[model samples]
Target chain A: MKADTNLSEGSGIPAEARKILTQIETDRAAYKRKLVISFIILAIAMIMVLIALKLDFRFMKNQLPFIFAGMGYTLLVSFMAISLACFLAVVGALGRLSKNPVFNSIASSYVSLIRGTPLLVQVYMWYLALPQIGKALEGYGFTGIQAFFTLPALTAGILALGVCYGAYMTETVRAGIQSIDPGQTEAANALGMTRSQTMKRIIFPQALRVIIPPVSNEFIAMIKDSSLVSLMGVWELSYRAIKMGRRHFQSLEMLITVALIYWMMCILLQYFQEKLETHMARGDRSIR
Target chain B: MMENDSPMVKITNIHKVFPQDVHVLCGIDLEVKKGETVAILGASGSGKSTLLRCINFLEEPTAGTVEVDGITIEAGENDKLRNGRIRDIRKRTGMCFQAFNLFPHMTVLENIIEGPVTVLRQKKEAATAYAEQLLQWIGLSEKSDEHPSRLSGGQQQRVAIARSLAMKPKVMLFDEPTSALDPELVGEVVEVMERLAKEGMTIVAVTHELHFARDVADRILIMDNGNWVEQGPPEKIFNNPEQERTRQFLAHIL
Candidate 1:
């Protein structure tokens, strides 16, 4: 406070300006203090609730290593699936934007069919129904078809998640692409750029800035949704937690532990997403 | 064979009808000779901008033909052929919009070089060199690395003109280039345009600035509704327009 006054006086700030600055500084200090107090209160409330719940800390600790070990598979599936989803989303968005009726119909139908069905049903179809169809195809004398259709649990999980998320992300991608001003396209066209050239050089670059935050959001949701693979015996986080809990008769403890783990992973992803948002927004003067 | 005498830009019976029967351009015929500057003055919604847009096929005309530099694209042609011809016309014509639609993602130099590098397939180094020269000509060499959003409206408009010029187009089309600028900032953009005009660039400008029309334009055309009512030398149109519609329009604006 002394230093602030000294600087203000040395700088010869007007009295009115000095008063406003001091008020702003005081408000900032009060805000910081309030935030700290709120955090402490929340932390205490969480501890009290946990104590009241009488959770099995010892059992939860024993199961931690096994459940944590499954994080690798969870992250691996999510990473691969998100990559596939991104590729499909770009292709789907292009198809949606295409003037060709055939492409538009196919893209719209894909989005509709996938989004209309439940992810659980889609997962079951990938894991179980595909092999049945392959067998039926084999009955038609198509050799080696069953082998092609019979995917491993991991591949089926990735496919289900990727294809499902791809449909949703297609709309996100389309909105992002459409968010660009039509003048940008006209400018590119006036400069003699072909449609594809304009899309690649001008439209997509601008659209990616608008698309990324939501894409990251979808990815975070995908991380949790990946637990659906546990139903297919993929032995991921939830799978391991469930197996351990049933064996030890500490289902509540294990469930809560796994939930916290998922929460923590999402938090980490959210932190990185914020960093990326800031990085992408650096060029936009309006945001600052 | 008589390239010097032939019109550089010729529009015959150009008509543009938007959906729901909005006739934006109606049977407009215009001819711009080589190195000639034509200023089209009109009030808001007078279709002057639409007429300019139709020249480059930015807005496809409902009916008519646009011939730029001996290449003609007629309305209702086969899609593939018409698109190819439209591209050819666009290649030869540089357009400056009222909104100064510089690619917000690119720096000033990058925005100028994008057309040459991507469309013209020039070497990046050569495009950059030319862009730098154009930037200097526009007196925005210091803003080469700055993004469009960082620049003022006038600066952005000047950069937009420089971006168009880097293409070395046969004809420059300005669609109310100074309309979006602050009153004080309009002169910089106007000055740059005046320089381009003095350098003998073939230009078709749709504008409201009466002074620019009077001083720089070789011919002045006053448009009302969707058709030009009076067209002549700057003095004749500004001082002694023969049409009552032109007189009324001039009176309102002046």
Candidate 2:
């Protein structure tokens, strides 16, 4: 309370307001400590549940190799989808930020439509509607119709996920770009750098510091969202789990096994995210 | 057509209006010959800074014609100067900012060399060599490798001047270059500007430092309410101001 009063005195904030703020800070810290203890207890309880199910876990053990094999596919799909999403996100961010009415409208519409509709519906659209268009093109005697529009389920899943995530990431990218002080751009312009040159050399490089952390978050979320692709018959973690569980009527065990694997994968992704954040923050003097 | 006789910077009938229809600069006309230093003094909202910014198209004049180093550009129907001509005009002038915008991510040396290497297509080795020279001139040779964030306010501002000078522009513009510095730090930046003036760099500066204006300026112009209210030599303007507003302003600031 003495420290709080001293801080309030120096800041010129009323003592009453400082008291309320100090109370809120104390309450939040206490809540966080309690939450940490609760999480440890929850982990112990989960381990006990695993021990109780050890008797019937033999079948789940046998299926682990089959389901674990799907990790490779999940990583591959997510990697490719993220790459595509990064490209689309840059273009979408530019369009949204551009002064041209046409570009602004197009970017706004794409983000609105994709965010408004369900990802599930978009996935199904790619799988079903694309082939219908292919057939229609074949009737019209388009020579490359078969190859161009013959949409594979895996490809459809990747495209759907990429497009959906790209829309969300556009907002993150735009905000990162906007966070830079306008004075930096004015200085660059005064030095005679073209608009494109300024963006490539000054703006984007600086924006990467703000962008990388959120982008890594999106990548982690994308790993979980990749499971949605299983609906299209892709042999990812969830799809394999469903098929094996249904064949032997061990659905609960199969589902629990895949969930644990997903959790472990997220933990690994989180470690990488922190490493990347630290790397990007190297030039920032305040971080150390 | 008057190539040799024209002033280095000749701005004709400039006006600036914001989107809300607030006229910040109203029908301003000015000229600066080669090797002449003009200081603009005004109250905070008098548009002196806006007038300096328009010379290089940093803040495009809402309506005007600007000619710098024999190249003329007029604001088109959309109230924007042609992009090509704007870049051309900007290349002919170096601008120092109030806040010392020195590209915080770069070291002092890198900030100075960036313009020449990127815009002028100079070799990296040559740009770096010249940047080292500039750092020496600013009395900051030891601080070249240090980032802007690591330097003191005075050091940062000196580096900003060195950064602008690297371009080798025909004229230099200073927009309240010392207003953001501490009282103790303002002297160092003013020292550098004084050195530049002695070396005959054509300069147009908007400043609140009247003593700096009185000591270094050839001509001093006073602006108020979006237009020029008085103009004369520094001695005449400071010692024998004819207008009541000029006398009042000088009395307050002096």
Chain B TM (all candidates): 0.98, 0.96
TM-score of the A chain in candidate 2?
A: 0.83
lDDT tens readout by residue for model 2, B1-254: 46546799998899999789989999999999888899999989889998898888888789988889888888654535568778888888999999888887788899999999989999999999999999999999998888898898889889988999999999999999999988999999999998999999999999988667999999999999789989999999999998999998898889
Query: How high is the lDDT of residue A92 in model 2?
Result: 95
- DockQ of structure 1: 0.64
DockQ of all predictions against the true structure, Cα-based: 0.64, 0.50
Candidates in order: C-alpha RMSD to true structure: 2.3, 5.0
Candidate 2 residue spans exceeding 4 A from truth? A1-39, A52-55, A139-141, A286-288, B1-5, B77-81
Pairs that collide, model 1: none
Interface root-mean-square deviation for each candidate?
2.4, 2.7
* Regions of model 1 farther than 4 Å from truth: A1-21, A286-288
User: Highest DockQ, which number?
Assistant: 1
What lDDT tens digits, residue by residue, belong to model 1 across residues B1-254? 59988999999999999999999888999999999999999888999999999999889889999899999988878776777788889989999999999999898999999998998899999999999999999999999998888899999999999999988999999999998989999999999999999999999999888778999999999888898888999999888889999888889878
